[model samples]
Target: MSKQYTPREMLEKLISFNTVSERSNLDLIHFVEDYLAGWGVGSILVPDETGKKASLHARIGPETDGGTVLSAHTDVVPVEGQNWSRDPFTAWEADGRLYGRGSADMKGFAATILAKVPDILKANLRKPVHIALSYDEEVGCFGAGPLVQDILSKGPRPDLVIVGEPTNMKVVTGHKGIAVLKTTIRGHPVHSSQLHRGVSAISAAAKLITWLDGKTAENRAGADPECPFEPPYTTLHSGTITGGQAHNITAQHCEFATDIRLLPEEDAESWIRDYRTFIETDVLPDMLAISQDCRIDVAELAYVPGLQEETDGEAEMLVRRLTGDNARNVVVYATEGGIFQHHGLSTVVCGPGSIDQAHQADEFIELVELDKCASFLDDLLEGMSQIDS
Candidate 1:
């Protein structure tokens, strides 16, 4: 096989398979599996229950014990309405940057890892380098949960997991945890002329919105004394609200989505309970009295924990060293790192490119960034070699 597969070639192979979060990653997984199998490396294919989408966990050395893992999600968010300058599924590079739907968010890192495997294998270092490419990360951190649980169940989980989310190649020690909460409010619709006869769900939703605004304001006002993040403390936001047709109609239904980012001790569940209490006590009492059918319901769309790298985190320190940086940093976006840590693997978020370029039209990862990543991998190899078998 060719040495150091050109970034173009690696990215070409990656972008050919449309591994959108809503779709299957089988083609991409099969390609990687086939490519790795050729080198006598075995892979474990952990398909989702439906046997549609899949996440692959494969080892480069002895699978018996602890090792270093290079993980990246194979899924990309949908490119539905975005006006792309070119085909989003086809890899194209211009002015030293590769463009595609997942180029920076982040098939580039996955491709880079696969490209680096040859060099890692050739090094014959004491520690094994494992690859964990997952699916459905864009939708939520869903696919990785079960796959990692299986790994932990067998014991001796990987020593560290590097989640390659875009961070301009910086070693990210922390990010906010996210909870996607949806709330639906129900009431009765009647003629606008008979406004008194109708209970408006849109109006109820306004009450819920006010409640959320209060939470956001409280956080904004008294963000934190013990906050560990930038502009830290929990925040609540309602993104979309829809109901009511014509001005004449009293809207009967309103559904809105609210997302919250909580501090570790804040306990998102407790906040959810508090929000439920507000609805049960303040918002719903009047509506329920008029009609027993009126209600407000909340459900979780997804939940992923925050990444908090230890002060002396081995994984964070290693990544910072590998990147040739003297200091580690933090990011605002959540990633798959915390989940890996939750499942017993010391993990940090580090990868090539910038999130600024991620999920944007004509998303791209610059060639310079890919070059820096290759150099980091080289540094990682040298660093790993220092440890005795």
Candidate 2:
């Protein structure tokens, strides 16, 4: 059970892979599967439909029902538009921080878990420690869905799941949910001079988009003072818009993407229902009166359930005891923890680094964070060694 690569070294190797949400993560998955194989631990892969990417789940130490699941996502956000001081794919250490695309948003945690493999094997315990590495988390927590189902259906059921989502090592018990919406408005096109003869798709889309903005404002106005989340309520906005062909032409098509983040107590489906009703009752009737072919299509591109603060939850207590932090906080962002919690698993979010560093240019996790995580893993190894029944 001798340790192999240090966390930074492993991070360096991991950051070398361009596991962007749009691309395949097979290389990283294979590397981890092989690494675990060398340690005599077999990994179960839950691959996507195309087999281009997969999630890895493995059990270490003794096989028992009440084991720990160390979860992390392998995908990183895109660096196309951002200006980085260094190559985003290259891992460099300076100013006591490691710089890379996934360093903070999570490959750091994944590396530490992988680095701790030898020590975890060395523990020789009654309960086990599970490793879960998923892909496509940046796009919408897409890859984690199958991974969760896999863990629940196959092998030993883990008693606790720790989602390493960069909480700066503080335990996070609740987080917001995200619903990605894509809307397409189809209208009749005509010469701009004859504005009264045909419907303008872009105009209709603008009205709908403005309506969404108003709804967002309404949600914000109704924010709960007691909620721990930043902004204290659900949020909605458009990320991208495109449609018009020319100023002289009445646009026939308009499309835009909306991002909806819901608080744990807010219902995402309810918002969607209201949106659909608006389109049907308010927006669609006017468009249809002008042209029967005019229509609006709204689709949910991705949805990640939100995690709620649980009272006397075992997962929260375990992390609180381990980190020695009695205080609980909620995050404005979403994570796979909610999905696990929704499926009956006690889940908590805790890991090294700050969410502030995630997705930003020159993203990094402080060297001290990695050191603290290493210490945390060591403590976990020792703690699990003496677990009761």
Candidate 3:
């Protein structure tokens, strides 16, 4: 426990934790809680029902309206199949970059915020600065839902929220929303020769998948010119499909997973409703004709809302001032910025590093990126101090 811990040192510690989304992040959460406690900042822990992982939130300076929140996620994606030059969990500094899991995808930004704690604590501030950390962000943003609900219920609304997602320190005003779903088809298995006596789940599943592909094509064909996203349209894609065992035997069960990314103007629920209708009305009757026992089931795995630029310009103006960037970018990947916006906070995405470096085999953040982030924090703290004084 030292009074002076640099961002690089903190990142080295964070990267060593191996907080893959499938594993518990309690160790990392506890480490952060302990660090904040040493600086006299009390934090609230929002744990999952299993108590294996948790989110931490703390406020510095005066507890008042119009406070700003610095938000980040604690978990990193799994590195099981990727080949790395060195251990993904061990951080190293070379070639002007800090290489490790979570170094760029996000722990870098978290470390920068943590490094500013002492200065934030010492500053005279009319408004509070909140630190919000959550788990399982890399996997469908599951952990942030409860944590965001807790933050909203606990206090007055924050004036602005900066989601520390790697954007090369540029202000990102928008991103596409993501939805993950799984579909299972059940039918009767029978010999291929006696196909009429049974329903082939694999066949039905293929038809459904083809239908989904048509939807994808349709979406692509009807691209919105005004959309700022790269594709400029919503997208639907299937990730995995599994069914059937023997060549002669008909498949009794088939399941496939699908992902959808929608524009901010697109209604996710409505798209899902159309999908459900297709299953109930179009796909179900044919299966039932063969056997009443045949059925199809669809389940939602995850949903993250898209961030849309507000007309008020509060979030944009603040981020522009902080980063000195006049242009805004839109990313295809989803983040918790949308969640914060849904909860009534003017949110923006601006942080260190590049998105291309995220989720890669040898993930790394440039030391220069961390330096830029530190400078941003210094300027922000100084501005807050001046306003409070």
Candidate 4:
């Protein structure tokens, strides 16, 4: 017989795997698959193109429509530079909290879901309960798109999705979208003394970065006072930059990465179009004039749609009924909920712990938070069982 593990034990087991975004999560995925199989629940694997990573989805109870999907990502952010007090992958307990790399950010919720699997099976749910474990969520949410597509195509359509992102168990009605972009500028190198004769890639990059900053300031100045987001407007920021070889020579190459977090009402395409137009009309002509080889290229690394507030949304209503949290809530951080919502699934963000602890040194989830989550799942199971098919 398969050994039954409590939620805390399951969490410890999950935290032992070093499934960082840069590393393959196959080990974790395989473990989950084996665990589910031991319980007689079959899972479908959606492997990425490289076969290095995979997403796992399983359904319990009747194969029917109007089901609830519990979604969580298996991968966690890296702990390379952070000054962790102990081994990040090894789970530890102290002061009524469980500490590990992904304890709060996400894996805590996944562990709870896995621990409740036996209860879910025994609930004899009239409606199905789907478990969606995705990969690469920390890095641009790459795995969720394919995972969502696979779920919709292969199985009965679920009525709602609960993305188990750490929200302290509050139901998040909406969240900002994100568009990650990388800009590369190639220019002719020349002596700094004769700078005017050659285009300077670093200078061009600076101009573009300045333009982005100006746009951010413009949005901030005109932001809606009643907006729930902390800054109350869209934000554009350049996170990383690299280029110039030395101070004496005009930079031959320059590259910088930027991300735009847009309010739910905004469209990412509009912003991308505006940025491209600026590059084509205002920035490129001068560089081309100096040398045809001088060029600017903008590549979109990723784009996750904003989760718009649905009027009388099914997912929102269900979570509110379960948690008794009616206060309006939203977040600035992006999540797979937006992608699921974009694909026509009613979605909400709710789970244990706090987002403030995510990706930090010595991350942890309070023991009380785990108990609250377990009670919520128990209530969910009871509710599912009571619903008529």
Maximum-lDDT candidate = 4
Reference-based lDDT, each prediction? 0.82, 0.90, 0.89, 0.94
Which pairs clash in the backbone of model 3?
A: none
Model 4 regions more than 4 Å off: 387-389
TM-score of 1: 0.94
lDDT of 2 at 51: 92
Model 4, position 136: C-alpha lDDT score: 95
Residue 213 CA error for candidate 3 (Å)?
A: 1.2
- Give the alpha carbon lDDT tens digit for every residue of 1-389 in model 4: 35688989999999999999999999999999999999999999999999999999999988888799999999999999999999999999999999999999899999999999989988968799999999999999999999999999998899999999999999999999999999999999999999988888999999999999999999999999999998899999999999988899999999999999999889989999999999999999999998999999999999999899999999999999999999999999999999999999999999999999999999999988888899999999898896555
TM-score of each: 0.94, 0.96, 0.97, 0.98
Could you give the candidate ranking by lDDT, starting with the highest? Answer: 4, 2, 3, 1
Better of 2 and 3 by TM-score: 3
Better candidate by lDDT, 1 or 4: 4
Model 2 regions lying over 4 Å from their true place: 1-3, 387-389
What digit string (tens of lDDT, one per residue) describes model 3 on residues 175-203?
99999999999988889999888888999
